[model samples]
Target: MTTLDSGERRRGSDTRPLITELIDEGTVESIAQEAWISLVGEDEVLVPLPGGPATDPVSSWVDVVGPWTGSVVLTTGRRTAEELTRALLREHSPAVLEEEDVADAFGEIANVVGGNVKAALPGPSGLSLPDVGSAPALRNPADLCRVELQWRGEPVSISVQGALPPLPAPR
Candidate 1:
């Protein structure tokens, strides 16, 4: 799949299963519990991941697996990740994850979590990578359909925007 946003064309080529399937496996295996599911999109969310307010200002990770690719980035915020973490793990022991973990969570969310949903697309031509990151003014995937879920009250956004056109598998 190839995507065009902000004048940049991202080319992707993979032929594997869907991202949602991967997410199901991870969610079941991983300790993170399954939360609510929403069908629809939303406007740009200025909310950044909660974590460190220092040196590790931000970090992003991206990877391509099977029919899709993903990226994730750790972030920080005014509310503080600790508070957000508490809310997310509210059902659990509460202190389960720290703010720093939020970015990693975001990255993983973009990867397996976001991947699972994006993979649901009909064609094999999907995304290039799950980019986990922060800073540089995160681009909004407004064009694609997205879903929002909350973990301990914190919002985890999942987007399934498609590539430009010629929605065919890459060679």
Candidate 2:
């Protein structure tokens, strides 16, 4: 049997699809809605309306790597995040919420949303643990899939953006 050439066996240049190509606003909204209902409250509904930019914004995200690599980010106002924590904890919530409570709840939300987003993408992927704080800078605008939503009159945005910068131009 003849040996195959290495060049012939090499994978074609950057065949991976962008986040926008793989996911849409509606799919992302649906995923967020399900997460809200399950984690925040059964009665809570994420209105698919742009409530404008968030005030005192805080973000939580989880990285996904595989056929596609990116971060699934959730951003909302600090007050809204605190409220979400309260909603999540229900009777377990203290009258005065702590920073740690907000972080844990918000991080959990990102984990749930990110997990679903990862599942929807092409398989054999790995998801990183959730992180809370500032949102990661968007690397490639074209590689982003975002959805704007309102929860209890608060603006929230979910963005799935590539972690790596755009590939260099072809020679």
Candidate 3:
């Protein structure tokens, strides 16, 4: 954020609450579970156990702008993403899934999860359209709320991270 005074731009102090203060790992896990059940299938479950790290990660995210600003990101393996698309699409899934198909389905899941996350946050906040690609880099570790889980034994991670870097230490 920027402060304007006397024709000069000054950096504003970041007083926003850290994501960890506003939310927690359990909350993020619960949110993801609910989204999975509703969108993936009523019986679909997200186990709290952490699986091995993703080999080829693909991420989908929606930017949240408000009293706390950042992106709600979902990251998993490309193969897992394809499997999720097939599961989400079910009978309607193509015999051969296209790249766009995976992106669309994966992005939709992020949208649902991100929307709920935005609502849980101090609002009057705006949610951006879901984007599929690499995950956003962490700006401040202290400002992150992250959860790791398994979906069909595949590793999946959800991160609610701050957009801005940490504030300078008071001198």
Candidate 4:
């Protein structure tokens, strides 16, 4: 078999764009706004302001794999998550919400946002089912796009971060 020159770059090596390059805070906010309108309530709006840090934070995310592999994560306080669950359920919500209820609703929000984010990226991508719990570690700082907002006066943050670590600098 014939081999290429030493300096030649391999196909599919270091070609994927970082998450920040592919998406921005505005696009992410619009996506989240649409999701909120559809899933939360017709009048619900996400105020585009940093609401500071969340207390007793909970997160939901979905993994995306394709030309770029990463996760789309949504985080908020536990009480806020419960409120979001109620809003999603609307009149169907029970007086006493269960942990599973919050998980299901919050995870669904992440799924919707992640699906849209995946569509925005260069495709032939695979999306994982949503997972709810702690946020995934930020593996590569350069590969992240994050937005902070307030929904019903509660803090919520959405972060799209690469799963892969940063590539080594060339010698």
Candidate 5:
């Protein structure tokens, strides 16, 4: 009879790499910039300066499951989200934006950004459907790679954070 390890032998040790180890802030910023230009519009640029805290904040995110599992979250104020929706929709935007409109548009943006982020990571990953609401609580701070930027003068932040807490130190 042949016996398989079943990954039990390494259970006490976690060799998984952190987000910081896999991707950097500048790469994330560049990804966002590309997504912005492609989806938001060529004229729309994400300035790499912090625009301060957001009021009436909302967040959209998608989960990535693979060697490094986590969420790619995009957060900004509700008003800014609406503006983003309009920018995304352009002339197709409704005269009065609805909650569903915001959710769909914002979720799509998260999808695009999340997709690009996933591609940059080590592959064989799966992405979850985008969700819009409050951002997920940070689990392992050391596994986070975040970037803050201004879009149309509003504060927007992108956080690529790991979903798991720090593993117990190897004995």
Candidate 6:
């Protein structure tokens, strides 16, 4: 949020929690839960891969925006991600966010989750922006803060990363 002539953060200074909680109540739980379940359901059977090539590993996300470097490391098979996308767009009418739109959706999801998560924290920022992508781990793994969020008992891990240089040394 930029500042006006007075040099104050234009968005506001008070009541971020209220704003985020309202959003969570309105959207996050339902959208995330449905999306997760559609991708990986106990009732649905998928051939277990032997952790080889041709077998698509689960997709994960890393949040690298603002002061909040939180990541959501999700293990979603290619099949699961595709199925989730189709089901989510069809049922929720989110207008079919394309792969090109991953950035947009990533930011949106991060913002939503951050807000809700912030509501739970006493001191919170105004919805950290989100970044998402398919990060394949090579010899050296990515170092990121990991948190698991479960919807109705299904666990999805979220990772939060620090700025490579720690937010410019806090001004």
What are the runs in model 4 whose C-alpha is more than 4 Å off? 1-8, 11-13
Worst ten-residue run, lDDT, model 5? 6-15
TM-scores of the candidates are 0.34, 0.91, 0.91, 0.93, 0.91, 0.39
Estimate the overall C-alpha local distance difference test score of candidate 1.
0.37
> What clash pairs does model 5 have?
none
The sequence of per-residue lDDT tens digits that candidate 4 reaches over residues 38-99 is 99988999999999999999999999999889999999999999999999998999989999
Clash totals for all models, in order? 25, 0, 0, 0, 0, 11
lDDT of 1 at 8: 25
Ranking by lDDT: 5, 4, 2, 3, 6, 1
Best-performing candidate as measured by TM-score:
4
Query: What's the lDDT for residue 78 in model 6?
Result: 47
lDDT of 3 by residue, 1-171 (tens): 875474323334435688987887888889899999988999999999888789899999999999999999999999999999999999999999999999999999999999989998998999999999999999999999988899989999999999999988745
Candidate models: Cα lDDT each: 0.37, 0.92, 0.91, 0.94, 0.95, 0.40
lDDT by residue (tens digit), candidate 1, 1-171: 975474323443223333344444233222112321211112212232332233333333343333444332323332433444344344652445654566544444344543444444344544445443453232334223333334333444433332322235455
Q: Give the range where candidate 1 is weakest over 10 consecutive residues by summed lDDT.
A: 35-44
True lDDT of residue 76, candidate 2: 98
**Candidate 5 residue lDDT tens string, 50-121:** 988899999999999999999999999999999999999999999999999999999999999999999999
Ranking by TM-score: 4, 5, 2, 3, 6, 1
Candidate that beats the other on TM-score, 3 or 4, i.e. the better one: 4
Q: What is the lDDT of residue 65 in candidate 3?
A: 99
Better of 4 and 5 by TM-score: 4
Count of clashing pairs, candidate 1 = 25
